[model samples]
Target: MDKVQILRKISQIFFFIYFIFFTSFCLCFFGLIEKFILKGSFGSLVLKLVVIIVLTLLFGRVFCGWMCPFGFLMELSYKLRAKIYKLKKLPKVSEELHNKLIYFKYLVMILSLVLTYYLATYAFCKVCPIGFLTNLYGTVISLIILITFLIASFFLPMTFCRYFCPLGAFLSIFSIRPLFILKTNNNCVKCRLCEFKCPMQIKITENVNQKECIRCFECKSSCKKGGISFSIK
Candidate 1:
């Protein structure tokens, strides 16, 4: 394989192994408590947050695009969909609707926090598909919900991430205008191939550091003209 393909494969494998051996090993919360009540005890969640945010500031949404075990699972669903439907990737979503729907994740974050405050429990955890995906010893209802979310991914890539994931919302808050970002560097041929390849449906030709960008770096390889590159600001 070519260098770019090799690098991408290596990245995916490396991060997937990281997820299996580390994040899942820590029960998927990375030791973060869902409720504020548990904040008194020192937890790995704090250190984990610092590390993830620091890396995100340096490299842009590395957790969501690469290191997230759920993200890796969602990618597998896309591959299965392609094999069944005979398409390169999942269907292209409308830019207008996709943009609007993405905002829903923020609402989910707000509502989750609000409900947790009143309920004195991490109410969102009951609905958190990732929580269920990781803690398989939980309720049957949670398993059903996670299954539903996984099934939905076949129709819409990152269905939960783009619309309903509270954690994704939290990350995007810090990820807005990350110091490191993708850039065109004047090499773009305006072919729009990168746009088509972007899972976030971002108009890469028009904007590179878009908040919706998860920094998967797939678009970098899609640029046959070598237009895209990562840069630190």
Candidate 2:
């Protein structure tokens, strides 16, 4: 492998480990803040908002590809799905449909923000499967949710990501100008490997700016012709 590939592989490994700790810390740290910090402090909420905005502005969906527990789980499910169903051979649809489905994430974002504004809570979190994954494991509801998620894994490729994940939705919109993104130059081979490998179903060549790209770099790794590149500006 070239130096770039080696570096990217290392980064992916680092992201996996860091995200495990990061999500755990965020869960626990925020829990402590909720327990100790006064709910009335508008400053606390403002501080968190600022942090999220800055992080999103700087990194884009790095958090989605690198830090989200749900994204992690979906990736895990992909492996298991491959083993049981051997779905790697399934035929793909037109690139146009793949691109169109990406907009669903934005709809989810709007719903989440509107709900948060009117109800003072994100409805997805109240029932998010990832929240269940991180927060509950052995309870009846957790077990039920787990079964539901596993079953969904059988039918849908990254079902929650394609359709219902609010966090993904949030990242999709907020990371419009991410610090890093995949850029295609005229290396000139439309092998379409990247399109097939992408978990989010993005048309990387035609729509690099699409909100659904999780920045997982799977496409870059799969491209054998060296036709694809990642850049930050």
Candidate 3:
């Protein structure tokens, strides 16, 4: 394989390793999800927030695409769905509805924050489906909810990140001008292959630096002519 292909493979491996660590039933490094679900009180959350947000301000939602355990599960479920529906794909949502749906995450983020503050507790944690993957060892309901979400991921790929993740809502605020951006060059053929591959469903050719971009680089890897590359500007 070419050097670019090797690099892409390396990136995939890194993401898989990160997924294992992030979702491990016992290990704790950052433990953002566990802290949110297990303990109602924030523990070193301000520090974690500052670090991740600063990184997002520089790199966009790399955290969502590469590191977040729930995102990993959702993407896996989506891939399974694609295989199941190989003969007949699901209908794509209208662009109008898609645009509106993008904003739903922000609303949920707001509600979560308000409830967290008003209740003086981590309000959503009690019912967050992510609890099943966390160290908390959640209840039977959490298990069922987690299974439901995994099933739903087939229909709504990365649904929680797109519509309910508070961290995504926070990170997206600063993604409009990431320090490292994906750019397409003259080699591009406008084949739309990259667009089809994008999990964020971005029109990547037109809006590589858009606020919603997650910096997953799937489009970069999918591009056939080496048209897409990271640019420092």
Best by TM-score: 1
Q: Using alpha carbons, what is the TM-score of model 2?
A: 0.70
What are the TM-scores, per candidate, against the unseen true structure?
0.84, 0.70, 0.78
lDDT of 2 by residue, 182-209 (tens): 7776883877777777776666777676
The better-scoring model by lDDT among 1 and 2 is: 1
The better-scoring model by TM-score among 1 and 2 is: 1
Candidate 3 residues 108-225, lDDT tens each? 7778666766675655555556665563545677677678778877886676776666667767887878887777788888887888877776776776645677666767777778
Candidate 3: 10-residue stretch with minimal lDDT: 25-34
Top-scoring candidate (lDDT): 1
Under the 3 Å rule for N, CA and C atoms, how many clashes does model 1 have?
0
- lDDT of each structure? 0.69, 0.60, 0.67
Q: What is the lDDT of residue 152 in candidate 3?
A: 78
Q: What ranking of all candidate models by TM-score puts the best one first?
A: 1, 3, 2
Off by over 4 Å in 3: 1-45, 84-91, 135-141
TM-score of 3: 0.78
